[model samples]
Every structure is written in C-alpha cells, then in structure tokens.
Target: MKEERRRHKRLDLDVKIELEKLDEGGVTTVKYIKADVSDLSRSGMGFKSNYKLDVGTFYDTQIQIWTKEVIDAVIEIVRCEEKENNIYQYGACFVGMTETDTLKIDIYQLFNEE
Candidate 1:
C-alpha cells in the first residue's frame, strides 16, 4: 500500500490560480499558462496544467480566494507527474508567506469548504 505523506489536511478545491514563472537568475519570462487548483492546504496546493513545470522551481503566484480576495505568495514546486492527455499535476508548497496572508487563507478555507 502507498503511504500517505501529506503534512496537513487538505480540502478538495477548484479555483483558478494566477502564476508567474520566476527564473533562477531573476529573468522574467512571458510564458504563462492557465491552471486550475485541485486541492488546498495551509502548507500547500495542487493544480493541473497543460504546461510542464520543473520540480524545485519557485514561482511568484497570486491565489484569488472566494472570488473576492487575492493574496500574493511564493511557492516551490514539490512534485510534478504527468497525467493523461499531456496534462501535468503539480504540487507546490507555500514559501515566504506573511502572517496576514496566512490568516486570509484560513478565513477563505473555513468559509469555502462548506
């Protein structure tokens, strides 16, 4: 059996996340692909995208919560596995998020899950 390795409880979520790829040397790229989040937690989020993303790469992102609030965050890709039809499943962990941003996330989580 496969062992569960998740550190926190996650909610099944479907939301559109805004993403910007960050170059290792701080070069900005114009390549942007739309992605839809599959799940969310305090520590991480998972999404499916048609574009490929390398694991361990950090990205500047904006997640809109409940269609009313938007928070800026940075996330590192923890895992990426190919799905059917050229889709990729990307798992990312939150990084460098502020305390106020976390509280915003908590409020969004509590209200949206029901």
Candidate 2:
C-alpha cells in the first residue's frame, strides 16, 4: 500500500485557537489548545495541538474570534503527527465548506499580504 502524502500550501501565522468539539446535542463541548495555524487553505488547515486527534475524526471548528463573522463547518482529520516536544500536529480538511467561507479566507490572506 502506498502512503498518502499531503500537498500543502503554507502561510505562517501565530494565531492561537481554542479548538472545540461541539456536541450533537448542543449542550456540551470539549476545548483544546491549537497552538498555531501553520498552513491554511480553502479546503483545510494544519495546526499544532497538545492532544492527538485520530485520523478520520470529525469536529465542528470555530475560529475563536471569527465565530460571529463566519459560519461553522465540519472538519475531518486527514493526518495526525506526534512531534518531539509532545505536540500533536493535525491536518484537517473541511467537510462542508461554503463558497462564502472560502471568500472570507481569501480576503484575510489578501489583507495579510498587504
């Protein structure tokens, strides 16, 4: 079997995130620290986390402050890696991304480039 490799588009950002798992019941949630967003794309993002996320695990992600301005989307863990410092790296893909969300990301990157 061949290992599935990732082709990534990277942007370095020091953004900290409160990664959360919103329950289906809408009454409970689990919070985790997402150290930074390493690489981001319209489809997904790569972040460093203290906990390991099993490959194929799904979640509802909220981008901390951007919550009110954007719609929440479901994401799936495509890869999880353990680093030397005990940090787990996660590569997740958006499961149901909207075009508006993609535009928002593009706009953010545009401003970032300026």
Candidate 3:
C-alpha cells in the first residue's frame, strides 16, 4: 500500500469551486477557472479540472463548507496529473488559511466521519 504522507485526514466532498490564478507577485490575475473538489482537509484539497494549472503555482478561491460558511484561502498547487479526455487532477496546499477556518473544517470532519 502507498504510504499516506498527508498531515490531515481528508473528507470526501463534491463541490465546484472557482479559482483565480495568482501572479508571481501574489496578485490575482484575470484568469479564472472552475474545478471540482474531490476531497478536502484542513491543510489541503484534491480537485479535478478541465483547465490546466501549473504545479507550484498559487491560486485564490473561496470554499463554502457544509454549514454554508465561506472560507477565503490561497492554495499552492503541489502536483498535477493529466487524466484521459482532457481532465486533470490537482493536489494543493493551503497557503494562508486562517486558524479559525481550519478549525471549521476540522469540526465538520469530526461530525461527518465515516
């Protein structure tokens, strides 16, 4: 079995999120794309998108949790793999997510455990 290197446990989730690429200077660019979140955790998330994004790049987005509260975060793409039919899977780490927002994700995970 593959060793799990993740710091936090991931929760399966299906949600659509819009992302705006950040420039080298950390400024948001006009380029926006939509991605489907496959799983989520306090530190990172996995998502799939038709639009290709570069690894090691940053993107800004707002994630709405199950409670209908939105968390604004910046994510750094750690890995990207192209699948068939132009789909790409991406792994990203939260760059500047606040502790309160992280706690919210944790709380949700606690209540929604399988």
Candidate maximizing lDDT: 3
Writing each residue's lDDT as its tens digit, candidate 2 over 1-114 gives: 976465534445555665566455653366654656676666788888877777876677665323336546677788888998889888888886678887777766676677
> What's the lDDT of the predicted structure labeled candidate 2?
0.68
TM-score of 2: 0.69
- Model 1 lDDT per residue over 1-114, tens place: 988778877777778876788887977576666889998778888999998998988788887766467778888999999999999999999986888888877777777767
Model 2 segments more than 4 A misplaced: 1-8, 22-35, 64-71
Show model 3 residue runs off by greater than 4 Å: none
Global lDDT of each model?
A: 0.82, 0.68, 0.92
Error of 2 at 20 (Å): 3.0
> Per-residue CA lDDT of candidate 3, range 1-114, in tens?
979989999998888999998998777798879999999999999999999899989999998888988988999999899999999999999998899999999998998985
Candidate 2, clashing residue pairs?
none
Cα misplacement distance, residue 90 of candidate 1 (Å): 1.0
Candidate ordering by lDDT (highest first): 3, 1, 2
Find the 10 residues in a row with the least total lDDT in model 2. 62-71
